[model samples]
Target: MPPRQQAQPFAKDERVLCFHHEMLYEAKILDIQPSEGSEGGYQYKVHYKGWKNTWDDWVPADRIRKFTEQNKELAAQLHAQIKHLQKSSAKVPKKGGRATGTDSARVSEERSSGAVAGSRGPRRARDYDLEQEDGFHARPSIKLPVPDHIKGILVDDWENITKNNQLVPLPHPHPVDQIINDYLEEERQNREPNSAHFDILEETMAGLKEYFEKALSRILLYRFERPQYHEIRKLWDQAGDDGPNKTACDTYGAEHLARLLVSLPELVAQTTMDQQSVARLREELVKFTTWLGKNAKNYFVSEYETPSQKYIDHARSF
Candidate 1:
């Protein structure tokens, strides 16, 4: 009989489950394999219960036990029906008996077909060849015909090769160059090119391209040297908090520099302000700008117009 499936633990072979009743259990089949000789299918002892420790019966996979809308009484009736089925099969005529000749002939034909199928014999399976397999996404496959062919040969002069220890990251050399030259060959073979690897490739190419662009730009920038100087100073001043050390040499540069110098004292005074002074400044600044800027403005506003996102992330974490 097949094993039953329930909300119970299921193991291999012991397919029966008992939830509907103690005597009547579920027989959800675990397997439908042939038994020891050529008699029929095999039912393994997956779980144990009822009549003995366990009972083995060779049954088909379609014969799984279930308990949908079933209870103790229905379960017992199902079990009785299965037991009757087993006994009724024994009353059939012997396989070679005159009355069972038709059944006997069918069994012989099946056995004869199976014997020819076996006599065809087994052949050796081919080994998994790396070259035969397609590379992922049509990428060039790593060609490593010989491991010992590559051992030691330098390529790029700027490249750093590790000696049993590599704390710094190094760039991947052209695969053929490494493989043919016998340098970083093992690592070259292991390196796989994916989306991230392609991104890194693009970034590296961009950096190399930028080197040439800047070299050309400096040659063409000779005409606007003074104006470019002023622009650069402005950017420097903005970066340096418009301080005394920052230089200015263009129109309205003096006036802007004066305003910056005047504001310097207020910025310095902020560090010394008591709570009362801070409150007063916060109020005055709010009235002047129509906004106090931020809660941390009084102490450090003119330098930083707003608190950094780092502070927001830290506050959010808390």
Candidate 2:
């Protein structure tokens, strides 16, 4: 006779609290399958209660807890913590050019949530720590091989804005959208027009562009860059009816785009993407960042312009 199968703890359609990254979310068990490992276990397919179905995925048994009164309280506490974090981080600095304390936390939250200007709402928090049975796994951290030169660029960008109070001149020579298009064109040249790889490449770039446009103002800017951002907004508003459909991508350049690239791993970790999907995303991101590094001299400005006294005053007043 075949060895007896282990009994499943949770059945299909059961409401449960599912641990995703660090936070626990209310979810429903959609399906259950026996684990393939020699040690008998189960994997559950779960749909997060309020999230889109696209976020549904298989989770291991250890990640699920019964929706008891105790677990429900735990979930509520977690939700409260998320709200507190967002509220605390939402405060922008009024005087400093540097990104410090709450400013950095705000950027992390905005990037993780893909939040754009004036689009604040409840979002998932990924900062909690959870200890597992075998060992301690805090949160899912993605490692992207940002090149050494790219690391240097990030450091310079920070110092120029915070320490030097200098800014990239407006209407950059290679705006972010154009850079993305150029990368796409290069990708297309090497692949068949109808190839699946090319299709994925196009899709990935499109998503990246969307994320950049949404994230630039909310998370990519330093406290000093706020004046420049306001200027761009003012121009867009002044143009009114005749203004072209413009976004941050039309104004900012590779410098800000580089900021977004470095923060992507943290942002990606906050999502419900499966391991395979996350791996694929990391591959594409690494490729794009490498490409960006190669063209840095052309895309990035050699001399950042010093902000005028008026601009400095405006930034300080904010």
Candidate 3:
């Protein structure tokens, strides 16, 4: 028999409040996707309690909180208290703001009465969730730990990309550009002048530069420019001999490189004029991947899941 699916935190038909588009709406769990990584790693598809199909979508487990009547009452009571406080304060004269002894006693009595009146029913999941949400809402809008200069970069260069009202961090163009340039110069000198080999080498070098640079820019913009890449700052940080854990940006860079290396033949088939050029480009791709794998195992490519089968095949081929 097939192995049993891992258990999920929330089950189907459970009432929840989902955070979507920065707003919380009542919803119900329709399905659960078990974690492929660790516990508490489930994703859920939910239908908003009163909305149409358009508003229905999958949300992360953390983004969906249990909706309870007790919590609802607590929220209502909190709002009512705030309203009461506002009204009581407004009654004080602007010229002489000190509260009279009678006024103070009356306000205290009202507060005590309100608390006693609303203190009913057992505590629910909503109570705990609301407490957490209060802290979450109190924090500054931007969640990423990026600096002002980084924010400047986002505003000036990456005006289009942002998440949670904050700028996503950019990935560093490490060793990739340097490796390609250094190889190009070394190969250029080593090639025989006025020969077909030299011509192929030059053409392949140009093709590889255009391919990698364009691919890197697009990949960085599309993948790294998101709040999900918050750990991306670690990629820019200088580490000791035993470097820090690989960041999301690092994995992305490695994946792109690996995919590019594996897909070289297909890419070369389009732009390359001769088999000689294709062969030369593939050789360079191999060198790049080899250097990446040796020098940066954690970042470039790990035994972890890769982007495609071709990447696996190519890495094994080398």
Candidate 4:
């Protein structure tokens, strides 16, 4: 005879704390379903509080706990631990004005090991591409140094779209792909043609292009930008070129790309890469983001354009 089904502990719309990596986030249970696994438990669809809808996902019972004062205290403790780890990792010593690959790798390894050992549950290997996946997970505990001016740009970008009802003009003068290529060209001029640094730079830029294209429609845009996204999709469809070749990278500019950079920590946390690989990727990302900040004036538009009344009406109709 089959094993009896286990009773469900959570109900739909219930508020709870769900574990993602070593941290606990407040979440609301959206739906519940019986587990199909040999173990006869249930799964819950959770919407993480304050996160985008794209981050909502189904999690097993083991990853969730009741939302009580105790759990809240636990969550705060975990958050503090995470912050401490990030601070520790960020202190890698510099060699010749740049972090030595060895030191960075060692720091990342220590951090990763500590997180795993201290986590509340076993880390599951996800069967999805890190580049394309979404939802909360263990983020590689590293921080990117975005400049103060660039932070101001992010604030303005948010205000323009969600508050002012403005839109970034399409076919931006400096598209994401162009900005990446320009950075690559600048790097190549200083490095040997066939050197390891140049090769990694090329591969990293290529990955960034692909990642920007995939992540834009998935997690990069806010709800206010959905109408613009659909419009872009319609144009691409009408042109009879819909596929990998037609992508946001060729149309969106540095503003959107900056959004992607800011979101990278969450995205990178979902990957199954080893500490060293994660560290290396972090280094490359830091270099590119720093370059992007320097060229912000040239790449980012001075002002966002206000959408036409007709366009706004059409968007609202959707």
Candidate 5:
């Protein structure tokens, strides 16, 4: 027989058509693993973009081909058709509430079940904690360990936190209250009957503070589990007691706990971190820092940004 055509080298995220069951499905290459046997070649781990995680799989190079311009155009047409079908079939929302129907219900079901579409064999833990038994055994049905508190966060929490009533207001002795009170007191002493004129001012100040604090707290929560936390923890731990990490930790009185909290989100986010996770992380950080003292809390949250932004910018450059 004549020589077979060589498979084209595809990079991660390149579009491709993978043969599964007897059909070709659109997928994106997630990883390329090199072959080690007598017949050297490669295999690909691909994510089926249209079918959700259930359809993700690993296949031999023979099973995949680079997606062409024709394939791209066809895929776009299919996507348009799907969206049209969904709009026509979806149930409209009642009154002021959200739309509910088969599509929405299916999404909710998929989230709760955490079931992948055509998933097979064993699943790997999101955070590979080798010391744990679940991490050691590669069971086909095994799931990443998600904390009870965060399961909802990893899925539906994003929708919940976006609503107007999502974040609860933190109790006031509010951070900026002293200045507001001082202004109000000065107005009151200026004239006994001046209270009425200054009432609006006080109310405005109070409202601004409430909203600011609420947003700030929620913002912190959203960023809590960002990947940057992982890098920070690793560096901080290796620096011992006299470096920047120790100084920051000792200054905040949180010691290594600070590093852990920062890193905790990285692991959790892999399994459960979403918009809701970020919101909750911020709220919790605010609460944690408040307990640590106002000045210390301010310092801790401020320090997180430099490293986090640095990591994000660096990743984007690549």
Candidate 6:
């Protein structure tokens, strides 16, 4: 029930008797948490009337909202709708050899109901994981290897690219690195004046594939690696004492905005340090920093520049 009259602001520690959870619940801001691990949003601690501790619960600022009696009615209506949908969907025979509908719901039902067998696997063939998973974090699929006949001509193609640039990096001792180096070196040795231009093109493609695969992986892992909420809360709590990197952790992303006007300086410092601590920062930067310039005139830079697998997968495949 909305208050009969006005209850004025319930200042801290002030209280009155409330018979029901519904009567006096409105979203009131607690405090903005700056150092919590999250991205874009006001990181708030809120008090909502709907919580287990409705009178005094701290929730993410985005999560706080008013509760209504109609919520149960809405849920019941949705359940009824789902049941009707399932009944209509069940009419199609489970014994049908193929399919009757295009919806994923139907497709899922067919699979569960044994309408389709396991024999029909994925249709569009994919190569392996593009990020080498084990260590190199390479692509997960097989690169279409140039056949031995084309391999010879492709070697010349690589050397031709080499002349335009400088010497390629010598392969490191790792078996994977060595294999890649061997392929490139062999191509250089056997380059005919008339090496098949297409073969060279493929070799150049191989170089591109390596760069893109690593660069994309590094970007993905860094961006989604963690959120700012809990991390910030912990650091904020700790900084009240003393913790290393406290200044850096509280600075970047959502941390920048939420903590409070007074605490903004510390949060800013944390953000800068957080960005600097990005894993393998320099190595990741080097991988594809020059890629745009190298392939400025070409199409499909994303595809061609990504190391298709380089020597790592070829070694694995062989």
Best by lDDT: 2
Residues 1-318 of candidate 6 have per-residue lDDT tens digits of 322332222333222221111112334555553423433233444443244333444333222222333323322333343344345545766675564311222224334534321011112222112122122111111112112323322333233322332111211112222233433554354333333322543444354334323322122111111232234446657777564333322222111111111122222334342322221222112212222223222311111111233433432232
Give the best candidate by TM-score: 2
Name the runs in model 2 displaced over 4 angstroms.
Answer: 1-141, 240-245
lDDT of each residue in 241-284, candidate 3, tens digit only:
35543443233443344434433433444452443333234334
lDDT of 2 at 63: 70
Q: What residue pairs are clashing in model 3? A: none
Candidate 5 vs. true structure, TM-score: 0.22
TM-score of each: 0.15, 0.57, 0.27, 0.56, 0.22, 0.16
Q: After superposition, how far is residue 27 of candidate 5 from its true place, in Å?
A: 0.6
TM-score ranking from best candidate downward: 2, 4, 3, 5, 6, 1
Superposed by TM-score, candidate 6 places the C-alpha of residue 232 at a distance from the truth, in angstroms, of 52
Candidate 5 local lDDT, residue 62 = 50
Cα deviation in Å at residue 156, candidate 4? 0.3
Ranking 2 against 4 by TM-score, winner: 2
Evaluated at residue 270, the lDDT of candidate 6 is 41
Per residue, candidate 5 scores C-alpha lDDT tens digits across 10-106 of: 6788889764422246789998876656555577899875565775777876556558754354334333433443455355656868635222333
lDDT of 2 by residue, 1-318 (tens): 434566677899999988765456789999998887676667899998887777888987757777977557555654554455455546765885666533354475455555442011224344332222112122344445556787787788878887798999887878988899888888577545654446767888888888888777777887778778888889888877586535778778888888888667667777787654554465456667767877888888888998789988887665
Error of 5 at 103 (Å): 44
Model 2, CA-based lDDT: 0.70
Cα-lDDT of candidate 3: 0.44
Candidate 6 versus the native: TM-score? 0.16
